[model samples]
Target: MARKTFNAQAHSLCLLVLVIVDAAAARGDVVSANASGEAMAQREFDYFALALQWPGSYCQRTRHCCSSSACCQSNPLAEFTIHGLWPDYNDGHYPSCCRDSDFSIKKISSLMPELQKHWPSLSCGSPSLCHGGKGIRQIFLYLNRNLLRSQFPDEKKHGTCSYPVILDEYSYFSVALDLYFKYNITKILSNEGILASNAETYSVEDIISAIKKAVGALPLLECRRGNGLNGDASSAISWLIVNEPFAPFNVL
Candidate 1:
């Protein structure tokens, strides 16, 4: 009888220990699951935060950012009101180049010809349009003329150069940012008494020297690819000229 009681006690203790261990394991599993769920929730919240910070200027006048055909042109107007150079959506339309909710890539590409048509007088020295200089000169003329003097204060300072700033093209499509810097530099030299009004006395080398001096003084020179972002020409130039670590592939 005593032996049987001892064996029964031992069996009961073993069962109790087993039950405790099983319960502990279950608790541990629940804790791990909860932690995973919390982490997922946190990640979702972070995504929402990023989404909230997205630029809201994607809409237009007759509609939201990408609403109308007129507002969403391939090469939209240069005017401040139509172009929307600033952060605020005032006087701006969304470009087809940007990621649009409504506009398609095919549609935007189709508009390039239309863009060339709308502004026929403004040329970038393209053979199809205004017939004039070639290569860099053509590029320079397009950028200088398309940029409105009032919008770009630096440009106003440059006055005008001996070289014809405006070239003949279909319509000025996209002005490069470098052109703005060059224009501003020219203006500063003119103001500083470096440039004489007499074109015969001044040569291209003199103009190049003035530009180099101005660039040396101005720490930031703005350069852009195609039509630039939000008139932040300085940053655009940084990305273009200097090493953009984030975008190694985006050389242009």
Candidate 2:
């Protein structure tokens, strides 16, 4: 299956909570994408796979490198930035924004506090887009128009279709955040003495072992090709899938 990062062009919060961040089984570059076309939208989807992205990889690719992300800029110990929680099909292809709901500032006003705290936009821009008067959502939209091109697309595209069973927009995002908190990759790695360093690349087995040791299962570690700045051909996890051993997390 393809593990996508909740990419951020500039302002929108990039949150890719693709799958489980728990007892995971590490899948390497050999991941099969041979899922049939019918699998793309044949059913309502099995469950969500909340994937996360490495801030360094995300920033470098988007030209917004480290300095912009709070985790990258200040806290060397911060965890991975959220990519998104997608509605996955039984196969590789997943469902996308299927509803007619347009992006409205009012829709997510209630989630602002948590959104701002955990899912803050990593792109650099003036914070005064809100003008004055309870216009935080307005500012958010401004960023969506100018800076955040991908966030809303990912949300509406996937979020719209993830209703009824997943509840609504609020459940979609809140669950992803909850999953993120449940699986702390950085802390998991550190516990096993596997510190993250751009200079060193850990093997898939090693990464999997560390995660399993911490959480008692395997996790999917998705990576991106190197961008020549590092000279290394493969970068560490740009995307991750934490697995659940007991049973797949399906409210269905």
Task: Give the whole-model CA lDDT for all candidates, comma-separated.
Answer: 0.21, 0.47
Model 1, residue 3: C-alpha shift (Å): 99
- Per model, how many backbone clashes are there? 11, 30
Native-structure RMSD, model 1? 32.3
Stretches of candidate 2 off by over 4 Å are 1-42, 62-77, 102-107, 120-149, 228-252
For candidate 1, the TM-score is 0.20
Sequence-dependent TM-score of model 2: 0.60
Model 1 agreement with the true structure over 50-144: per-residue lDDT tens digits: 00100112212224222222234455432212111111011222111111012122322433443323312221122221112222233323333
lDDT over C-alpha atoms for residue 152 of model 2: 41
For candidate 2, give the lDDT of residue 132: 26
Instruction: Compose the digit string of candidate 2's lDDT tens values, residues 1-252.
Output: 433321111221223233442233222211111122111222455556666655554454455543333433554324465666676664677654344333455555676566554554556543321112132234335434433434443554455555545555566667767766777766777787665454444455576677666655455555545453332233233233334531233222
